[model samples]
Target chain A: MSRGDWASWLESWRQQLVLWLESTPAGDFVNTYTWAWPIAESFHFVGLCLLLGTVGLFDLRLLGFARQIPLPQLHRLIPWGIAGFSINAATGSLFMAAAPFQYLYNESFYFKATFLSVAGVNVAVFYLLFYRKIVPLGAGEQAPWPARIIGGVSLLMWIGVMCAGRLLTFYRPSFRFF
Target chain B: MDPVFIWLEQTALSVWVRESPSMFAFPGILTLHTIGMAFLVGLTSAFSLRILGFARRVPAPEMLKLVPVVWFGFFLNLVSGFLLLLAYPTKALTNPVFYLKLTTIALALLAVRALGRRVADLSFRPVRGWPGDRVLASLTLGFWVVSVTAGRFLAYTHSRLLASDF
Candidate 1:
């Protein structure tokens, strides 16, 4: 598509999304309640902690940070991390619905979303390609280079997500193109 | 307290933390604070869950290696949190919820220490843990949740934005 066509298409899509989200009760709860925003924010932080704790720790183990931890024993913690991710997804969607324009137009939101995707894909790659290799390695064994790289990527991506999420409020997109 | 806030607010460091245009100022520090929080609470909670029988096969003593990292996280938060307090003295000190946040942190710290001592006791061995360790772990988790809630509420509950605002 031409540049102008792309921009117009984006504009129309954004407007429609805003119209749809504005009607959702998630936005209404956020807009109408006094404590709703802060509470959601708290839960979001909690979820991030849980994710970092289980999944992040597992990453650290893969990177050979805490070598004393048995890989399978530590892998048990992944479920809690999944739960954390679910909580964040729910709250994060609620936030976008609450103020669609704030997120859709913000550059930081784009970066955050990209980082989240990288983290997600990185997980998939680890489980599909690298899981079997790490399963046999007992405590204090060095993880292969592939696992280490994946762990490093996961750590950096999550940190990037957090940084971009924090900066979202600061970057209000003043668009002349769209 | 008001006089103390007024004086602290005008200090050069406080001024820089509050008004610096650099992202390294308020935004960077807040981000660091959050990262510290994730590591500190996350690692501790994971350790606690293990003791609570969530990950039973993992030997308890080996997990003690994580203590230093948890303390490192705590150190990061302590420094960042202090800088944040310096930036907006009255904003935090005046809010009752701020006090609540502090109290919860104190309680959480105590719970953490107790839990750690119990875990360390399990060193070089694996047993059911100390008699009350499960209760201690549960309390630690609860305190962390309360602390996190209180910390988030601090932004919304403060009546004063700056010492000078009053």
Candidate 2:
């Protein structure tokens, strides 16, 4: 689709989000849940730390650091990583729910969401495409070249998500532009 | 405090950081600051959990080996953070939340170092039945999370934009 077509589609999404957001009262206690936003934001950051830390460690292993550690042993950390991701998704939704138009229309937020989705898909693809062959290969065996490539791509995609999320404030979309 | 602020503002790097017209001057530096935060906070949390015995199978020392990478991320954030402060010394210096963020980071770093040394002590293997490991792991994760969230709040809670305003 052309850029214009994509923009139009995004605009429709933004409109729907606006309607949903407006259904709530402007002074809704949920919006002003004094403790809630900061607490949720904290949880979100915690999740980011967990996700990045565990996943980054695994990627480093694939890239050949801590060669003595078994991949399965390292993989044990993945569940905690998933827990962190769950926290972020939950908190992120609250932020959007509180101010849908601000985020839905924001270019950086859009890019962040897009990158996150790509990273998620990449993780799924990594497991679906290579898990069985790699897992049975066992401890001390070098990761297959394909798995290493996947690991590298996963790292890049996550870092992209981080950068985009960080840059969100800088690229706040003008509400008037819509 | 005023004199100290004045002296800081007079520093050549601070002057450039505040006065430079290039995007690389302010906005670029801010972007780097946030990226560094993600890496630093993220890696710290991960390493903390590992140190606390979250993954008993992976050798604790092996997890400690990631320290250099975490430090690299920390350094990136430190430098970027300083640049951001230089750009608006008054903005950060006057903000209670900014100070809280700094203090939180300091505590988190200390916790990481202390935990790292403990984890490195090859004699200190995990006891199968003891809950010490789990408690330590939870504390490490908790501290890093608090630090990151406090850091995020700095943007929202600053008291002043410039010295002149105050």
Model-by-model DockQ, in order:
0.79, 0.59
- Least accurate stretch of 10 residues (summed lDDT) in model 2 chain B? B127-136
Please give the lDDT score for candidate 1. 0.87
lDDT of 1 at A85: 93
TM-score of each: 0.94, 0.85
lDDT scores in order: 0.87, 0.73
lDDT of 2 by residue, B52-159 (tens): 556667766666667777887889888988888876788788888787778877877776676667666644576321355445556656666666777777766777
**Chain B TM-score list for all models:** 0.94, 0.82
Flag regions of model 2 displaced more than 4 Å.
Answer: A1-10, A24-30, A137-139, B10-12, B15-23, B127-139
Residue B21 miss distance in model 2 (angstroms): 6.6
What pairs collide in candidate 2? Answer: none
lDDT: worst 10-residue window of model 1 chain A: A169-178
Model 2 chain A poorest ten-residue lDDT run: A21-30
